[model samples]
Target: MADTFLKEQVRARSIGDWIALPVLIAVIFAAPFFPAVLTSVPNWAILPVSDWVGEGLNWLARDAGVGGVTFADVTRALAAAAEAPIDWLKIVLAEGWVTGAGFNKVQAAPPLSWLGVTLAVALVALRLSGRGLMLLTLVSGLYLALFGLWVLAMTTLASVLLCVVTALVLGLAIGIRAYRSPRTEAFVRAVMNVMQTVPIFSYLLPTLLLFGYGPSAALFATVVYALPPMVHATVLALRSVPQETLELARMTGCSRAQTLWKVELPVAVPRLAIGLNQVVMMTLNMVIIASMIGAGGLGYDVLRALRRLDFGAGFEAGMGIVALAVVLDRLTQAAAHNQSTQAVGLWRRRDTVLALALLIIFTLFSFVIPSLGLWPKDLTLTTAPFWNGAVSFINREFYDPLDAIRTAMLLKVMNPFRDLLLATPWTLIGLLVCFAGYALGGKRAALTVMALLLFIALTGYWEPAMVSVYLTTLAVAIALAIGLPFGIWVSSRPRFHQPVQLVLDTLQTLPTLVYLLPAVMLFRNGDFSALIAVVSYAVAPAVRYGMAGMKHVPSERVEAAAMSGCTPWQTFRFVRLPSAMPTLLLGVNQTVMMALSMLVIAALVGTRELGQEVYTSLTRGEVGPGIVAGLCVACIALIADTLLKSAAARAARHEGDIHA
Candidate 1:
């Protein structure tokens, strides 16, 4: 009787009881139907279905009474803010660069001869990455010059370099503060999420309002967009430093600043260098989006070419950006990699030598080459004509057929599935997600996903949220198809791993917008087009996580499986995969988050989601709606992340020994 009483006291009845519990998830989502009694609920069909949303968008656009912007007000606000100076020293050292006043500004001198850039970059590359990388820089410079995108690429490079420097300083400053204070650390983390999740378009408006439309606006935007990663990384790196190193500095009676500069900073240098590299890479990732707000350079060229439907011009222009990225990435990455402690003189140091050479060449050219002394006029390489011809041929020969195939896929496969998904009972999705949550994590995970998504519904954007969810599902599915196989193949050979890792790094830095033009050209505007974009962007994480998981799988377990006479397939499937399951889930979580985020960019090809709404609302000056929709995307990402992370944690306890 006592045993029965104890068993009853400790029964897992909440799991069963919660099955009948009212889905308290009305906060993030709305029901399709409700009675007057239930109508009092927050998300009880607040916004109708597709029919109402279409009408609201039309009415909002036509209803000029609610939201509007005046050009004069905007210009006045910008002029006042842009002239605000940092310290006079910083102004002289950094941001005080003056350019021309007209339509075509002479911001900086251009390299006249292809040979100048090649030689300078080759010197840098050779010092950093040796013969092979030097050759790459030279070849990449030639591509820029030969394709007629040299000037535009330089424009983009100048802005990126400016942003990179600014981001590093700001990130280091904030990171230092955050590391010193627990409060600041928490605050920094909160802001990082906002910075990371807020659409780039949303970011541009306030920046434009403050700085006006120029490289300055774009530069600040890029800085703001890229700064958080370095800040977070720096704080983490500093915190991870050995306590004994800090103690030694204290023992020397070093002042706080001296301790930091003399001891802590040196120990943190490698990690700080990594942060600096990330700053550069993230700046590169904002290319075409940065161009949208009036920043000039290769992005502008690509945008103009895209607008003109000149695929060749855009393609070459994009390649110019890629070339520069390749050169910069290799140089920075190589310098970080070999970690040479052999002290060398400043005169012979790789970075110093390269910078000095560039300076000398530029200074000399100012005297000798009239063309290089100023920005070039009539600087057209004219890839446009070829692009135009290709556009015609593709539209006639390839695109139409591709579009037909895409249409068929949509009609036969995607559209119906999307509809079926949208029409699925909200309860069933909640329950299924809840079940997965419980299985992966537990009750808490299920509740978090439920609560976050329900909040999106309460905001009255559930349908577009639904649409976004559908696309996210599709993109992740497709990403898995590509990432999983490549992961398995890469696992077989050690030689392929490093190069594949390098490719993944490049992909991480490759701007999503730059890829959008090509994706649009190939796939056109539709669900399929959007899917391709998401797949390309999201697959890198999947592949990375999968490789990490497999590589970390214990060799002893594999040997045992082999000893049991297991085939390779059986070994991987039954032993390795199960062992790596927890880490694989982590990768899937990232893949899903990335896919959801990319949906906003994918909307350029016409995806109807919170992303599309956020884009449209930002343009329309509907800050409320824009913020709400952006929140929905965030909520969705968080929900999935929480659920997956919870599951991974629970499962990791069992498989936590696996390194990957």
Candidate 2:
């Protein structure tokens, strides 16, 4: 039967189909050889995302549609934006009032005698998470006050408060909706995928337009950018609420709303708090980034320090951001943990107390020493010399040679592969997906892939979508190469698995900005750099799940393999690997989604795919195009996720029977 099945597969295609595929591929290969292929002619024009990137460069160099750079006009705008924040800040610090001529930005809290603010905050901390959290919160406040950053910290805090509260409300509401309705769940998940996959850098331009400048825009951007995690957590929390508990609630003859409010929501609170915690941390992080668009406070200070090449101030500010991230992170985590364990005590209440104490200390310092959060007039610290010098050194030293490799690969390898990918007929690809999905999972899986692919086509970004698909395919291949073996090796040894898991966590948490651009310098642009960046970010889940699946190999199965005089390789291959294959497949599925996400983010380093279009659309102020491309990306994630999850379920059910 196996031999007949193999023969049937070999004879599945007609000669003409095979011949036409290659010819079609070759035609795509030759088209790009024409210089004007990407540009427009008189009547018709083909402007790929790559073309838009070139145009953006020209726009920056030339005056674009505007007249020459009017220094006075530019200066007037900057001078105005610059003056408002400082003036508002001074008032807030001095009179505890920010109300101005047209802006009734009345400071909310009555200027707490800095001392009073501290006591109030400390007391609040004492109520929430316990003594340890209270102490940490107190120290944070004291540090801010002593450093004279009290006023700035308060400004930051006020902003954090508003954005996070809004995020929590929206996230919780949507999350619950997602859990209850299939359509809403699909829509919400789709939106979440796009928000997560799109780069922060890509959205900033559009955010600038909508928010209409300053703190208002920044706050709006903050809320939008950070809302997804909260929503996702809320949904997951609700979904994971024990089935027995829900049954019990229903059995109580309670009305649906009553059951939800008194039973379901309370039961789900522990997990739902995770979403709130995530929202808080995310909101805080975005606030620091908000400075880019004139949201005042420490973020702007860091931005200025970076522009001026002041490494010291930049470093200090960066630390401050990190400290802030940690404090918020700790508080949220404590709250979530305490709630989850249903633990109640003085210690558990500390996080709230700590937060309040820090607030007070912050207020006191704001009115006293001004420099804590303020940059000195000379603005002595900068990183320009270092960054510029390093950039120059790398470009001249290592990147040049690396670029040569990129050039060679693009001309020879990727260019050829690009053609091969395009040559795949939509119909044949559909059949292939259907067959693969059916073989691994079932009818539902086949339909899922069809829907995903159909969405990509209907979006009117089919060609660029194919390019993205090709790049993601290549990335997944590379990711599997690195992640699988490591996963298998670590899983085999009990001692090493824990350590490997720790490494995976670290890789997952490191911000994309830290390594993504540099990775481009290493591999250069196009599919290669995008591939590496995607591989770096997406590979973690693959390894983690692979390890998990393998380590779960039944003890009896392992023993049986040993009894058969199996070598280590034989044991893993014949017993462990087969057993873990299902989980490993799920890992690959996650890796696919993650690869797409990173591909979008890596557009910063120049990827000639849908992400580039998303980038271009934002710059051109074309929201429709950007969102269209974003939907395509989301479709790809959902497709892979659905099919793989189905397969994992099937495989996990096979029990301890070793195929070998």
Candidate 3:
């Protein structure tokens, strides 16, 4: 049966497939004979693109300009304007307003009382959602206050709020424009693809050069990082608006603008809210990374803790970020889904009036009772000693087993895979990718994949790129192995679904930085640690997508399989799995992207990959190398994304054929 199936498969191939097979095979066999030519791109062929790009950017920053003003001057002016609001918000949230510099300064007013802010947030949550969210808001706010993270948390909150607002406005405008013009949409889609695939670190390099080092650069980076998702969400939401709604608007003699504002936008609100949630989460994520550029907040504290090897301090700050993320996520989600009817006048609304009254009352009381303004330092708590003790005990008691597992994994699995990838000839790999692309997609995909790979090779980053690929590939495999089964089990057991989903959601919500802390604490610095961090960070998508796929499988198909005398395992293997293959492949794509993203952060734990290259370039102020390394990482992500999407498409088609 196997031989017959193999023969039939060979017989089904087109002439092009047959021709391509031998060419791929020949390239693989010929690689060893011409190692110098095939194994790597030689010096003569390597392009100095990074240097050229660096020079061009420097000129744009320093020399190139129109009229009397240089580009740097314009950017500085804009930065100054943007900085004004941020500085004001900082004062309002944490740093009380002052009239003068140094010892000569006089306090104009204390910032909003922590008591007031907490009450206001709770009121808003109650008004938009219900008692559950209100309680959650109160608890999260209290956690920050009690842990002595109020000031830093507030500072981070200010930055996040500003960035989210900015990103939303810009994303809406751009998305609306793209919706109106197909050409514009196509162009914007291409740009968004690059923006989404490019590692977050790449964004800081250009922002740093243009805006200089400060909150301005961090603000700009945060906005850019968070902008793409909002734009995507806006476009998708607008496109998905019901056709019946549009027709009704036309029948009612509505103008285009009126149709959009009065009909489409209201309908799109729920979906757009999801985008808002994404923007909020992404802004928080970037804010932490932006701390490296002087955007001080909880992220700065976390960074400082990491540097000092103070695990306790880092955990506290990281939890502060999680608390903030949860609050914002819930508030925004509730606000979007809010369906309560409002009175004619805003002042007539009981909840709104009460919330405002609470804000005013608390702020007024803060002037006489100063403790209400900010959580008193002496009243705060610390878990640093407890955490330190726990870490010491674990290390002292469980060191051998943990070290043994790490060593075994590295020696037996990771190193061998890394060596194989590094030893593989670039030419053979390139051809293999081309053939795979052609087989999965077509000529366009083939050309695109080959070109992207070629660009990486020509830039002289192939070796490190291979290292990155090895780490990501292994991490993704492990994540899928673990997540897929768990997701399947949860999907099969109805009672487990909600709890498992909540766990996955929380994992995804935590910033990538937090994953590094535990991994580094346990495994120290190496591929093993990086692998653990990447897997923990990337596993959520796998579980989420897999569970979704399994849960969505048609009940009719499962019933039919069972009725045909199949056992439960046979029904799943033959019926449910095939039906879910396309979605599972999509899950794989997401897992790969998430893994690649975490790998960059894992560089901090001393992995020698493209992430390290980018980090090195950032620290050394080498724009050219940083940009090149970032692009290489982006290429790897795009390649994986494209191939997996193609495979998913093929699976869907095959499934459809089987159904027919």
What lDDT, from 0 to 1, does candidate 2 have?
0.66
Score every model by TM-score: 0.80, 0.68, 0.95
TM-score of 3: 0.95
Candidate closest to the true structure, highest TM-score = 3
For candidate 1, write residues 1-660 as lDDT tens digits.
997985674465455546534444552255556443333324555544333443454344344232365444454455444334322222232223446777866535333344555677787677766789988988887777666666567667767776787788899899999999999999998788657766666666555544566666777778888898889878987887799988988998999999887777677777887788767766776767778876777887777776765667776777777777778877866765555353333126667766667756764575566444333446635566676677567767887678888888789978888887667665556666766666565567777778765666566776787888888988898898899778867887899998999788767766676556656777777778788888899999999998988988889999999999999999988889888888888999989977876788777667888889878875765555665677778877877887778767866766654434
For residues 88-143, could you state the per-residue lDDT of candidate 3 as single tens digits? 89998988788988899987888877888898888787767779888988998898
Off by over 4 Å in 2: 1-161, 177-229, 243-262, 277-327, 348-358, 365-401, 423-427, 491-506, 520-527, 551-565, 653-660
Q: Give residue 560's error in model 3 in angstroms.
A: 2.0
Over 4 Å off in model 1, which ranges? 1-114, 338-358, 361-395, 398-401, 425-439, 442-444, 502-506, 657-660
In candidate 1, how many Å is residue 204 off? 2.0
Specify the poorest-scoring 10-residue window by lDDT in model 3. 339-348
Clashes of 3: 0
How many angstroms is residue 502 displaced in model 2 relative to the true structure, after the best TM-score fit?
5.6
